[model samples]
Structures are given as structure tokens and as C-alpha cells.
Target: MRKPLLMLVLAAALNGLTACASAPSADLGSAPGVKEGSTPSKGSTLIIKDFADRSITFPSAPQKIVALANGEMDIVYALGGTLVGRPTATVPAALQAAQSVEQVGSTHGLDLEKIALLSPDVVLGNHPLNTKDIPGVEGVGSKMVLTSANSIDDIKKQIGLFGQLLQKEDKAKELTQAIDQKLQELKTTPSTAKTRVLMVYGAPGTYMAALNNSLSGDILVSAGGENIAADYPKLDNYPQYAQVNTEKIMKSNPQLIVIMTHGSPEKVKDGFMKEMQQNAAWSSLDAVKNNHIEILPADLFGTNPGTKVVEALDLMSKRLQAAK
Candidate 1:
């Protein structure tokens, strides 16, 4: 991005920050490792510890950038960084600034050649999903910064990272503070009987439960829903997700079945519903019998919503409240 535009954005953001700063605040908590700009590199280079725990060094701040995930892409644009290339996904309405960015490929199926030709100074991607592309990006002398967002703190960390990268540290602080206040207001209601919810995320054939550590699960818990998959054994390959346990699910007897799909919502939901119908065991669950299943909005829940996190929390809280 040009220095002038960056300056104008930061200046314009002060109005938002001032408005948000007027809100009440409460002390919350945190997580670790990828704190964006936590490390210092040799000489004038900038060193940042990515979510993968790899130290990514860039000579000065990166200008040409590639974003491989919608969430990270959202953060970049929010921080006033324009992308040379981006992944193929629905740009959240709030991130309309990125709607015109060039599409590269999906996270798992990246067009390495196309990305290489863009000659981005740095590439932003999600942990695990985009870590495998480090070689491809590095081969072209570009650095890859990977991050995971399994919780609100993770989202804040992303803002921090992008804010620093875009040279908008003050804006990042204002953003995090605003989010913190909003979250405190959305604190889970204290109830003797919490809503029992089974949070599921995946494509049609391959389904997984969102365990307590995943972002979806975190959102569930934050919204006063008791996650049935909270204590389930984590999958070795995907610690945040677990293999669906029908027996355990039946035993838990959840009141709500919340779904977040990775593909076409209509197709994914149809496939899931078909599976539930074919298997009477799943069909008989209280959540199904009561018709309390809910498929979250794709832009807000399926993947990370980036700066739209507070909105996601508000939506989840309201849904759980109505169900209760």
C-alpha cells in the first residue's frame, strides 16, 4: 500500500477508535506464541513469530502481499494492506474492500505458479492448512506467515499482527480494546441449565465435531451453549476437531445441533440431513426430534470471520438465548 493511503486510513480510523473507546471495559484473558512482531531480526529486517512458531524475517515491512484465507485477508484489508493475490472464498460483506483482489486458489489447492508470478513480499495463511505452502512461497523468495484462530484471543492476535505489518499499531490497539469491551458485554449468561449444543463442522462426507479448543467450540461456549464435544478425545491429526461419536452424542442428548459447513451450504446441509435420516440413531436425538438444528451463516461462522468476530459472538449469544 502507498504510504499516503496508509496515513489516511489510520487517521480516519481515529474516529472509530474514539467512538469505541467511550464504551465500558472489563478485564479478560489471553493465549500465546504468535504475538506478531514479538521477535527482533538481525540488522534492519523485521522478524515475526508466526502461529507455526517459525520466525519469519522480512527486510523492512512487506508491501506486495498474498492472503490465502478469507479471515487473514479480512485482517489485511482492515489494516489497509492491499493484496496482490487472495484465496477463492466469499468476501465477507464487511470486507468489501477486498472484493476486487485477485483470486489465486483455495487454501488446500493453491496456484503456486500464479502466486509466484505475483511476487508478493509476504504471504498470510492459516496454520496447518497453509503451512505446507511455505516451501512454494519461500522458493520464490517470499515469506509465509501462518496463524490459527481457535478463540477470541487468537482473533485479537491476528489484528495485532496485521496492524504491525501495515504499520498501524495504534489502530490495532484500538481495535483489540473495542473487541474486548464488546465481548465482555456478550459474556455468557449465568444459568443453572445451559443449552446443550452439538457443534459440527466439515464437508458432506467428512464430518467432525468442533472440540472445546476450536474457534467454533469457543464461540459455542462463549454464547452460553454447553458443547457436548467438549471432553471428547481429539483427533490425532486435527486436535481441534474430533471424529463424531454417535454413542456419546446420543448419551449427551444435546438440545441443539449447530452446524458450520466447509462447502456449499445447501449441498452440505442436505447431505448431513440425508445421513441423519438414513441413520435412525442420529434421527432420534433430542435435537433432531425437536427440530432445533441450526446452520450458522457461512461468512460469520464456518471459517474465521476476522474483524467480524464481535458480530459472530452477538449472533451466537442471541441464538442460544432464544433456544434457552
Candidate 2:
């Protein structure tokens, strides 16, 4: 999953975790088969059932691509591809490939006018967030592929899709294998008896507990951290998160806290800390008093990590183990 861009209006507070009811019976991440490392066959295009399970047909291997989310941008770049345009978000650290791409605006506030002017062949975006954007993208003569990396499986599926789309299956497999190996190594980490964790997503002064459905929460679990917010009812609009409750936090008494935010990390952290101090019980929570709080790297946590997912998982695993 991404911060969502969610870091989603939880748009940015959480980014990439959702299931679309309108999707087809097929897995959203599946793609039409092609030979490994083979070029697109003549007189044909690629097709994929996006994360929403919608059928998306590519007229040809997209030349002028517009990636509407940072995670997507990172993935495209990781596949040895460049972008014609990208959202105005921080690119992941591993995506060192620079492009002279235009800023088409954020995932939530896409500048359609600018997008149309680009005449992109393909537009990649975060699902559910960009499902409504299909019309706008199509209006610009571009086919949109909306996908998200909610879990390790989701990330691998997305990478495979992009690999097929970019004619870079070899690279995609390499990236996916790294994730597999990392996860295998993680299985060997001695269980910490489920280190209690509270993952909060920040937007301005407001914050919500990220639920198990979120990308961050997914990684938290892989790292052996049990999300105390797992049982909380999800927000109708932002299903990946729930309204943060001090009473709930106190009752859970989590052993670790991880905060993910978009802008001004210090301000958001300070605001949360101020709120915690106002309540003696909240301040005395194990995570708080033991200084077990962690602010995940904005590039890797709040948004979808894409090709940087291996690093993201490694970071989360270390965090959980440290708290243990």
C-alpha cells in the first residue's frame, strides 16, 4: 500500500491498500502472459487486470508514460524506464535514476489539464484513489493502470505487472526474488511473542491508527509487530485506518509505535507527543516511556515503496526486533 499519497486526504495519511468491489473474478494483479525478457509481439499490445480487476488494454508499449503516484513512478524507473510525468511526491531513495519529467500534481489532486497536454500512452496510479481518474486519463488518450502494493504478495504482483508492461520481466523477477529472499530470512527471526505495535498515519494535526489492511500494517506484521489497532473499526472513507483513540492506546499498551506522515514530520510528531503528555496514562504507555517510538522514512513508509520494498521490509523487521 502507499501513505498513502494517503499520507489518502487519509489520502496521504495512508496510500495503497484496498479491494474494489467492481473487480472481476480474476486476481487484480494478473497479466496476459509473455515470454521472459521478450519484446512485445508485432501488431499487438499488453493487457493487465489492474489491482481493481478492471481490464486495461494498452494500444502499444506506452512511450510517454505518466505515473500519478510516487510508488508507481519508482516502479517504472526501477524497470529501467523513464517517465514523461509524475506526481509531486518524494521519489523513493533507491530510485536514483533521474528524469526530466513534469509534475502533474498529487494522486488526489491530479492536474487534468496538464495531464491531457502530455498525451501519455499509459498512466499508472494508486487504485481506488485513481479509479475515478480513469475517465480523465482515457480522455487524454492514455490507458490507465491502477494498482497498489498492500502486502508482500501485492508488491510482487505489481512488480510483475510492470515488468510485463515495460518488457522487463527479468528485472522484475530480480526485484521480486530479493523480496522473497528477504522474507525467507525474516522467517528465521526468533519470534518476539508478537511485539505490540501502534502504527499512526499523520495528516496535519490529525492522526489515525493504520489498520491491518494498510501497507504499513502489513510490513509491521511481517516484522513480528502486532498492530493494536487491528481490531478497531475502519473508517468508511479510508478503510485502511481508524480514528485514533487514547483509551484504546492505553488499553493496548503497545510496546512499539511507528508514525508515518507526509509533510513536516517534526510538527506532526510534536503534535502527537503534546497530545500524549496531556494524558498521564497515555504518556505512561510502554511504547511512550521506553522511547520505542519510530518515525518511518517518508520515502519508504507513508507511500508505497515499490522497488524499495525490500528495504522497507528490512527496516520494519529491524524496528520490531529492536523493540523486542
Candidate 3:
């Protein structure tokens, strides 16, 4: 009887071991339907509404990011988010260390292959990026967030959006507050004169006028200067700027000419001055006659002024007040 009892006990232990072996394993450190080890438990799902009015749902806050626009990059850096990829050339001096990050491409174009390899969680850009490229970016499992900033109010909104996306609302509030404070100060400062200013962006052989809708033009108006390009017909492909017309410029006879360039300010100014000198019609313009031509600092004007827009406004206000 004792031997029989021992056999039954041994059989029960073996059956228990078999049941334990067949049991399902626990999925450690993973959310339901999410891949194991994919994201941290602290991360929360977020819904982002982009400039295009499209809603994008992020499984979690983006850990790897690619900001294709200078403004986007600036806002991200200001919020203390790390960039996995960025445009190599246009990044500001304060964010120069970002150059060490991967080069995804510029606002003019994107390298789909390199971007794919990086496998960024989110790619931030504007409408200028081809919609056709969306599939290629999505093919690599990356989401694109399109954004724009045509005015100071838009910039503030974008700052808030990025703050929400990056979970950096405190930093965003601080930055926006500082920008608002500066803008308030500008509003209180008395203008020396109501000057008609023409803002132009210059490349080696190309020039374009900033319309009232463009970043510089909007700032120019806010700073108490009149934008002469306000009435210029917008370019078909580039609505923010208008084609440079020497005839119209001569006709406008702007009291101040603000030249914005990404290259050497002196060289750009000399080129415009030389072109003006050759055209007797341009010579008669009030700006040329009064030597009111000024090259805006590249950081504040060459691209979207980003968080430094207040500086641009102050600089323009000072210059406009000082102009004869």
C-alpha cells in the first residue's frame, strides 16, 4: 500500500511540471499590442494636429526626431529635445552641435534613403516638402508632421504645439513669454518715422521680395515700418515672396532697403549696390539717394527668425528709427 501511494504522488508531481511547462509566458515591459521593449511604460499616446489640419496620433512621445525646417529645429532645440537628424547648413550657431547629428536634408529637398536608415519616429517639415515624398517616409514607418509659421502668432502656436508634443510645456511657456515681453516692449517704443521699407532676400544671382505674408515682411509691419511689397503680386509657386522687379522697386521708391542674405553681408550689399549703380533708374530711388540700404544680420533674417524674432524686431525698429 505504501509503494502504491509513492507512485501516485510521483505521477501527480510530473503532471504538475507538465502543466507549468505548457503555460503562456508573461510579456514583460510591454503594452498590449505594442512590441516588446518598443517604448517605455511612462510614455503616453498623443494626438497632434498639424498646420495642414491633419491629425496624427503618436504611440508615444517621439524619441527619435528629424526637423527639416530651421524654425522647427530651433523650437525643438529650445525645448531641450535631442535631434536624430537635421539640415546641416541652416542650423543656428547656438545649435551648432546638432551638426554632429545625422544630416537628413534641407527644406529644399530630402534624402529619403538616409532618412529611412535613421528611422526617425517623427519628421517635422512644412508644406514645401513634396506630398509625393510622404509615402517614402511612411514606407520606413516614420510619421511626418507638417508645420508652418508665417506670423508671430503662428510661431507662438507652433511653440505650444512642440511643447505639447515633447512634454516640455514649461520651457515652451518660458520662451513664448519672453518673446511676448519683447514684442510688448517694441509696441511701446516710439517710432522715429513711418518709413516705407522694402525687404529683399538675396542669393548669389537670385533675389526675391518678401511680401506682407512672408516672415520678414510680417515682422517689418509689426515693427512699425511699411512693407512696400504688400501690394506686389505674389509668385505662383512661391506665394510668400514676389519676383523682384526693378521697375516696381523704382516706382515704390522705398525710403529704406533691407537686404537679407545667407552669405557675406558685405558681399551681398556690394552686389546689390553695384546693380543699383548700373541702373540709372534705381539710382533715383529715395533709398539709394539717401544711402538707407542695410544688410540684416543673417541669423535674424536669412531664415525664419525662430525664437530670436524679437531681436529681429528690435533691430529693425532701431534701424528704422535711426534712418534719415
- Top candidate when judged by TM-score against the true structure: 2
* Candidate 3 residue-wise lDDT at 281: 88
lDDT of 3 by residue, 176-230 (tens): 9988998888788765667888898887667889998888888888888888789
Lowest summed lDDT across 10 adjacent residues in model 1 is found at 20-29
**Each candidate: what lDDT?**
0.75, 0.76, 0.76
Question: What is the Cα-based lDDT of residue 123 in candidate 2?
Answer: 83
The TM-score of predicted model 2 comes to 0.85
Q: What is the TM-score of each candidate against the true structure?
A: 0.80, 0.85, 0.81
Q: Which stretches of candidate 1 lie over 4 Å from their true place?
A: 1-45, 188-192, 278-286
Instruction: Write one digit per residue (lDDT tens) for candidate 2, span 1-324.
Output: 433222213331122223222323554334533422334653466665666767655656677888878778877888888988888766554654644578888778787666766778888887778878766556545677778777767888888888878778889999889888988888887654888999999976899999988888888777667899999999998888999988889999998988999888888888888877777797678888789987889988877888787888888888887787
Task: Give the lDDT of residue 99 in candidate 3.
Answer: 71
Clash count list over all predictions: 0, 21, 0
What are the per-residue Cα lDDT tens digits for candidate 1 across 151-239? Answer: 87899988987776666777888888887887777663466678888888869687788998888888878767899889989999889
For candidate 2, what is the lDDT? 0.76
Against the true structure, candidate 3 has what lDDT? 0.76
